[model samples]
Target: MTIAVSTIIRPSRILTALVSAVAIMVASIGLAILAGRIGTLGLTPRVLTGFGALFLAFFGFYHGVRIRKILQLDIAGAGQIRLSEQREKRTCSDSDWPHVGKDMQVMQLMPGSTIWPCMLLLRLRAEDHAVRVVPILPDSVSRESFRALAVAVRWLAWQSDSQESSYL
Candidate 1:
């Protein structure tokens, strides 16, 4: 029997806030560490910290904007997964030759992939060797669809692990 789950993922405000918060925290820590060493760099602590703060603010904003892409994901049975961006126009300078609006047969689920009740981090590798990391949050999809996707992804991961172990 084959279980297929398809879902359209929207941008989540929760994720944006989370990413921004993390970026801010890291930036603060980095600035604190750099504060002690600014004397050797021949720059005043106030000037260095001010520039660093501005740079981190821009960095956080950029990443928050970058995560707002709409996507369509399909998990077919226990063996196939496809992902495509559903953007109205190309936003980045990079070519969208293979995956944008097209199905990509994922060859592997790379490391650092995790499934949590509130979020799912899918690090997928396509047949062409391109890798994409997809972050899915509960607010990104309908409640029922989110539940179904989580179940399907967990089942797929389990099935893949079992099959690999059987071959070894």
Candidate 2:
């Protein structure tokens, strides 16, 4: 009998969002105060402060409603993968996806960019031509976890290949 093993990995997105909101709020308040100090602190700074406050409010809302990342993987069988992220939760499984993240990838991040530094983005194919982008390894995390995930994917792919060949 073939045994199925479940592997779970969680990522930090809600906390990240909260931190970003706080950082933006601080910047907004600082700039607003600086602008107030001068008779005319220039239009540029005022505009920036407005944008920052708007973004801060948006992130604050997200932070309040943010949920945890939860992924369930069954690598021993038909590439069953379940994901619960933000407000979208769904499960996908098929022999076609023998490997859950066969196309998993990562991108190097820079400071002051949309994503924090040293983070990797793993892209998984979702339903109907859409893609699910997951951010992992927030900052300077070891690559061992990434390797482990890759190995599990490869093993699942092998299982799928063998199953197909056995039928043929």
Candidate 3:
């Protein structure tokens, strides 16, 4: 029998902290490099430093806002998957799945999706052929739910591969 799994993804403090730490490190190295090349680039120190500060502020704001979305993901036993973001929910199946909302569109699991013990990187493709990447960290969900999700994802990937091979 196919496995059905549902997970509610909360905002992950760990992920946020990690991102912030990385951004800080990157900004430090970037400023260092800019400082070293300031004379060669023919730009004044103040102007170059201003540009660097602006870039760092923009980067921090962008990522800070992007990581706050709460997600609800469901995978049915029949290989149907649903993803809900805020009040908008979309479902996709192996074949033609009907639309669930006015703005809802089909989304399928794409290749290169990775599931690790601590994280899951889901690559999803929409009906409009746009790809979206979702990251799930351990702190985002319960331990039991995390383990179940990993197993379910692996099974779904295996099922998809076998089905594709059979068509050949």
Q: Each model's RMSD to truth, in Å? A: 6.8, 10.4, 5.6
lDDT of each: 0.72, 0.48, 0.72
Off by over 4 Å in 3: 33-57, 87-106
Q: Lowest summed lDDT over 10 consecutive residues: which window, candidate 2?
A: 105-114
1 or 2, greater by lDDT = 1
Which prediction has more favorable TM-score, 1 or 2? 1
In candidate 1 the C-alpha lDDT for residue 78 amounts to: 53
- Which residue segments of model 1 deviate by more than 4 Å? 22-46, 88-107
- Report the lDDT tens digits of candidate 2 across residue range 83-154: 433224443334443224544322211122222234544455544445655555532123554444455444
Worst 10 residues of 1 by lDDT: 89-98
Tens digit of lDDT per residue, candidate 3, span 10-101? 77888788777777776766676566643445457645674676588568857776868877677777767667674544333435433234
Name the candidate that leads on TM-score.
3
Clash pairs, candidate 2, are none
Candidate 1 residue-wise lDDT, 12-119, digit = tens = 889888778877776665575466533445457655675677588778878787768888777766557778777563332224323434344555666568999989
Report residue 17 deviation for candidate 2 (angstroms): 7.9
